[model samples]
Target: MKLIVGNKNYSSWSLRAWLALSLTGTSFEEELLPLDTPEFYERIKLLSPAGRVPVLIDGDLAVWDTLAIIEYLAERFPDAGLWPADPHARAHARSICAEFHSGFPDLRGQFPMNLRREPAPHPKGATADRDTARVREIWTTCRSRAGDGGPFLFGAFSAADCFYAPVVTRFLTYCLDMSETERAYAEAVMAHPLMQAWCADAAKETAVVDADEV
Candidate 1:
């Protein structure tokens, strides 16, 4: 399998797909395209019609969107435990992932994922504030449901973790307020080996996206 991703310093969606793929314990080749560049546009066009990063290619099949890539990986590698085994837990996980996929515009627009940014509080808006509170609520709810299973959202580092991993980075990068529970969950995601590896690689990149630099 070959995965095409964008600049690690700013591509949150790419991180989602990459993390899920990594959890599969599958050998795959990765290609990083510097975002917001002519090269990225030219190269990504051939990979997917969406012209987005995080395209996973397995054999002759190409999965474009982040959620689609994750679903494909989960189906292909059932033993990876990408999603929860319990039907109820799996549905809950998918619900949050879908919410994250289509919602949270305020938080996302105000705080773009930038691993290279120094940790500090950035100014926020009302809707962004509400978004943060909603995220905390989601975390608290997940913890209550899966507290005994493990430290992760659904416990055992499933697709739910991958979906919110970038939000964890956003919280830390912008020094957003987090409760003890939320902080602990964020810490657990950051402490994962794959996430650490991704961060290390992100730190080594020299490319810059001017829009996300703020």
Candidate 2:
């Protein structure tokens, strides 16, 4: 598997796909493409017509889009349990992933993940606050589902957790308010070995996206 991504410090979508691959315990090659570069459009054109980062190349097959890549991997590696074991839990996880994937443009625009940066004041506004609240509500509900066995949503660090990994990073980066449970959950996600590796790589990246530099 060759996972193509963008600047680790700036690309939230890339991070999601990367995390899903990591969870499979499969060793794969990585291609880091700096965002907004001439080389990107030219190089990605052959890999994915969408010209997007987070494209997974598996031999002759190429999967684009973060969610699609994850789904493909899950089907390819069913034993890895990319999703939950229970059908209900799995459905909930997928629903949450969908929500995270497409429903919070405002929060996403306001809180770009910057792993290299420490917590700081976030922008304030109605949309921002509403997004934050919705995220917290989702976290609360998911944690309730996790019960006590695991710290991740639906437990066991499934695709749902992968989908939200960037959100956790964003919360910490912006120093956004989180409840005790929410903070614990976020901290747990950060402490995961794979997440630590991602953050370490992100720290080593010198590239910057000006628009994401808030």
TM-score for all models, in order of appearance? 0.98, 0.97
Distance from true location, Cα of 19 in model 2, Å: 1.0
**Candidate 1 lDDT by residue in tens digits, 1-214:** 9999999889999999999999999999999999999999999999999999999999898999988999999999999999999999999999999999999999899999999899999999998999999999999899988967899999899999998999999999999999999999999999999999999999999988998887
lDDT for model 2 comes to 0.89
* Model 2, TM vs. native: 0.97
User: What does candidate 1 score in Cα RMSD to the true structure?
Assistant: 0.7
The C-alpha stretches of model 1 lying farther than 4 A from their native spots are none
Residue 40 shift from truth in candidate 2, angstroms:
1.7
Deviation in Å, model 2, residue 58 alpha carbon: 0.5
lDDT values of the candidates?
0.94, 0.89
